[model samples]
Target: MATDSASACIRQTERFGAHNYQPLPVVIASGQGAWVLDVEGRRYLDCLAAYSALNFGHRHPALVAAAHAQLDRLTLTSRAFHNDRLGEFMERLATLAGTQMVLPMNTGAEAVESAIKVARTWGYRVKGVPTDRARIIVAANNFHGRTTTIVGFSSDPGARDGFGPFTPGFDTVLYGDAEALAAAITPETVAVLIEPIQGEAGVILPPEGYLAQVRRLTAEHGVLFIADEIQSGLGRTGATFECDNAGVRPDLYLLGKALGGGIVPVSAVVGESSVLGVLRPGEHGSTFGGNPLAAAVGIAVVDLLETGEYQSRARELGAVLGRRLEELVGAGVQSVRVRGMWAGVDIDPDLATGHRVCELLAERGVLAKETHGSTIRLAPPLVITAEEIDWAIDQLREVLAELS
Candidate 1:
């Protein structure tokens, strides 16, 4: 396809597709490492990574090659027949997640929806909760995915607005507060669903030891714990699993995005066998759940994570980035909270707004989007090098200083 005017393309898309997203002006055509080149051949550093999908960066050669090879041989077998790569992927993902089983799905929302099923079923079968009274506890300001059941539990109004009558049976507690979670659960409560750091809530971190406390409390209550690591897992947060930072073992792990290496849509529910086994044959599935193409990419992604190279990179750069952000605190910067490669920077109310800073960033060759009105999230691909990190940071610092 020939590159057209980005605005024209945007108009065409808005005409056809849902107007759910209000995106920045750039329309990316190609990318490498942490940089994307738009249709007009202007380059911008990719700080969002498709909400953490591009942790390996766009069109990573190895992952692209995997997709190419798989495409040549086979793509989909519909889960009706065994594909050579699916078992390998399932095995690797399960092992990597320290879980006994893996159930593949197409999107993060599907995986989260599947998790809801697992949690509710486990409640009835294992926890002995009444059939209709299976309650799952979620933290406030959590963004699991956009499925009906998932959004039903979201604390964000915009995501859930006008989308109800919502799914019931979910309980909410203050995020990062273990005491609130403990108090919210009754005997019928089956599971506690949480994001390790509440990424969508301005990269909010729980108090130190909060995850550990959550671990202890869940264990004591025998309620399953679920970690929605869709945005933070697979080395995006300087750890294989963000829960590792606290050594918490969740009963269920929801994964997506980076699992497909930016090649295809893939998600999974990794958890103990008994809990996952609750789904009998024909209970739930997708046509492309374990397709060979996605399976191959999933395998490659797992291999990359096992090397520990990217995680180390994220860790090293994270410290430098955090220090740099801290220097901005109380300056034009209102506050900064960083975890691994992802950061949420709060803009000063008087100096400049997050949207303005992001627009200035776009002009300066760094691309980031604003969230929650005043915060801009930074989540470059893990494959970005030290030089690129410095460059992106310099770009942001320059714009922020100018705003100040």
Candidate 2:
């Protein structure tokens, strides 16, 4: 139950803030490592990790120190003037993504929009497509961003409804079907944008060899393959990129979420010079894209991934997570899909909804979130211990038993 302070805060927020999100009735006060303290002084393990933005956990020392140092030195100078931090951030991020260029942005949605503009411009300038005639192929059930253009091609009605007169120039195809994707391509197609592992769509993974086929088809058709790694990249999938795990490379990588070490909002479009080079100055930019504070934290994030420690943690820990979740398949959980440290567990509709199960989990001191009606996603911080993983699953098991 919520205390007076927590209830009062929730009431005030509901009264003033927009009703966009249906957050759990928990008011977080502060956090350290994998646990957060609520207003009532109750602690809970953070399982969602701010939708994977807090991969290193809250207030990670290196990231916090980087932010503190940058805050004391400088913050934003905008693109009108160069700050001392942007160059190193861009260089380090490019090296980390194994690409030649970086087009920084402030959010995942901004990065997606920026990549769209870049792909269209590239098609018109280099691919020889007619002006305003370039088309991009996207997967169904894909969740790239909430922006108008991004949602314009979305297959989910919840994301597309009430946002209409949607943008054209996008074709929809089945996510893991190579034949459908191939058939959707045309001479006017400029790029094929997709998520390597669909994080929002219940952590759905493609069929085996699907990514390799995408690479081959794009190279053969001269179409740019843009991977929206906002939720799936940056060591979330047990590798620097899910593409790396699959041994396939894309022409452009749309990255965000954990890139700022959860210290600031930092995102970017990483790609080769020939593709990202299409954007000239004044063509497309963000005011706070590469600000000094964001850059400092981004650089620190890159440094963390360079060690390969976090990726190894995800791989080893993910196996344990998968095994525990699979045990519940017939015990209230209808199915489960896991990759790296991320999982999508589908609750049996006869038992309860995912939201109700998460609420019960929260009551038991573990915090998680539901993606759809019956699917809940689990993405703990990479720093989480094996013991903590077991405890979180234990809480889930108890919740399922109670529901049963």
Candidate 3:
């Protein structure tokens, strides 16, 4: 919506809100399937899908049903009392992840924090690393979250600027360099954390064979390999994991984004029993971590991903989107990156800006978000039909052509 109320709301945000993000002017009020209805009653195809959390598409009936049923029974038990749905959620999630233990949390960042804690504790209790010396290594161009410790290793200046004095114990290296990771790990290093595909860094994928090499090297070094799959996991990448494409497995997985089925915020650290078991009684926890409402929705999400059709939908559509975007190289596009149903299109800066293009896209009934600079990321719901995807792509093509 770009009406009086919409401008008023935007002005309110500008006045009272932290100016962290420069969002477009459109104001949305409702969504169904892959389409969001702005306050002005304009229906836009949601290409960002809330950064993949709406992978099941906005307001899937089955997931909404699950949320409703859970709300009628119980919502939060807070670990002081056990929730009925937590165990089932953990079991389904662990099975889907091929792991033995699942430690639940509420946000992707909190899940990441939990993974760091688990790694350090596992180093001390199991791997015999010295106390308080355990270190975790991350990559450049990484966006784990905005937590103080997570931002400590961030390579992006805007993310980390003025946020210091930062936390110690995190080392940084290049994104796709396995050798850099090997060299950076000291004896004090307990975990080498990575994203299978760096989403926030313009959808940067690692060099082929890099993941497998890291998997092997981490094993050889007696260091745990931790994966932050918040933005890339749960079939967003066609496979259950983007790491699976390289036939690699990490010791620990930090999962979020799509796990709550877009109904709630739920995340988890799934790992081997010994690794996740490091958290002792009262050592760490969250108020909404294993709450019953989230657990129910999470179980439903796992069930949704288990279907073969869902993964195949992402794979088949991702290829179509990739080919169309690659053709943009001849159509004034600077570059294109595609993995699963996700794509990062780098528009030519000389012609028009990413922000301007996005504003125009919003006007023409498509919604994508800009990342880094000069790049707009497109990740529609996997539930989208081939026809819907083609329609969205045609809209993008028309818009880009008009910009010429």
Tens-place lDDT per residue, model 2, 15-99, is 9999998999999999988899999899999999999999999999999999999999999999999999999999999998888
**Which of 1 and 2 is ahead in lDDT?**
2
Least accurate 10 contiguous residues by lDDT in model 2? 278-287
**lDDT winner:** 2
Q: Residue 396 deviation, candidate 3, in Å?
A: 2.0
lDDT of each: 0.88, 0.94, 0.88
Per-model TM-score on C-alpha atoms: 0.97, 0.99, 0.98
Tens-digit lDDT string for candidate 1 (239-346) = 998998778878889999999999899999999998999998998889999999999999999999989988888888888778888887777788898889999999
Which of 1 and 2 is the better model by TM-score?
2
Stretches > 4 Å off in candidate 3: none
Q: Can you list the residue pairs that collide in candidate 2? A: none
Model 3, C-alpha of 257: deviation from truth (Å): 0.8
Give per-candidate clash totals: 0, 0, 1
For model 3, residues 36-76, the per-residue Cα lDDT tens digits are 88777878899999998998999999899999999999888
